[model samples]
Target: MRDEKWTARIEAGVEGLTKAEWAPDSRNILCFSEWGLRVTIWSLSTGTATYIQFPKHPDRGYAFRKDGRYFVLAERYKSKDMMGVYDCPSGYKLIRHFALPTTSLASISLSPTGNHVAAWEAASEFKVVIMNLTGQHIATFIPTDDPLLGVRHILWHPSGTYLLVGGWDSKLYILSSLEWKVVATIQLASRLPSSTACCTIHSS
Candidate 1:
């Protein structure tokens, strides 16, 4: 589905775009804009759109639960740090928000069960931090090399035991949740001629 093109509109204009995930049951596409400020949930079947506005003018990051009951969103504002859970059927109301130690949020991913969240912050270097649903820090998954690669685009495996990450480095890393180690690294050929790549693990 990565190669297929869909239509979406931004504040500036409309254009063809690719999405991270499509809700099979609801026909909604979950995607963030290039700037990451606005997250749009679009209905492919009906051509309807819903826009969720962030409290602070920070970059937007989103994740969807397996059951599609709830989703998580993280925003980075200049003075106030924000993170919240939103009921999918309704609009974003505010589950939690806090003052962040830093000013930048690199990315955000939610576990398959919707019980935990993983977020990345930018400092001298990037750092991956995990938090529970109540807005409490649980642990940090620091990569051996640059954390930017793994945290840039993260997706929770179906089993919730691993995280799949890919980005500009052209390498996909499968990170183990138990030891927080990179168990497998898959590199794409330089001549693939694709701007982005994503993965989905199927069960037997």
Candidate 2:
């Protein structure tokens, strides 16, 4: 990475901008407008722009596939939480859109291998739904027997072997990629997920 003076400038929307980040390709900038309204993507190469509505969360509600070819974002549509997958290189077209099975959907992420997506509900419910590219439900994982207090975060390992999930209940759940089952559960200190990063287990 090199530091260089940039000349490109993107003007904000009528509602003004909340946050902006470069797309995986490094040529496009995704600008999120205020109040979770819409995301305006400005392409530097093509000098073109595109927009998508109802981005659920500015930061964690969207993720790009590892290859940077497919883009997915969580949305709030007609009082329902939805997920939309877009084709980044194909003029940012809407390739797939469907409603997610959750009331308060917090975050949605594409797996490292690009074979599936993992999404979870916020609040006390320990509901994490796994689905394929076509919006087919592969599995639903509930780590605890009873409901948890809150879901802090969920991330897929870069190797695509394990999915790390944690919550306010102060526990971390490691799920195997094979069946999406809870392979191991680890207890944590009062200060949690932020401090826990990589966990290695030699034996399953």
Q: lDDT values of the candidates?
A: 0.62, 0.86
Among the numbered candidates, top lDDT falls to: 2
Candidate 2's residue-wise lDDT over 1-204, tens digit each?
999986898888487888999998889999999888899999998788899999999777888888988998899999998989999989789999998888999788788999889998887677889988788888888765564476788888999889998877888999998988988998887744744757645786
lDDT of 2: 0.86
* Clash totals for all candidate models: 1, 0
Q: Give the clashing pairs for model 2.
A: none
What TM-scores do the predictions have?
0.54, 0.86
Worst 10 residues of 2 by lDDT: 191-200
* Tens digits of lDDT, candidate 1, 43-74: 66667677655533233456666677676776
Per-candidate Cα RMSD to the true structure, in Å, reads: 10.7, 7.3
Off by over 4 Å in 2: 1-6, 191-204
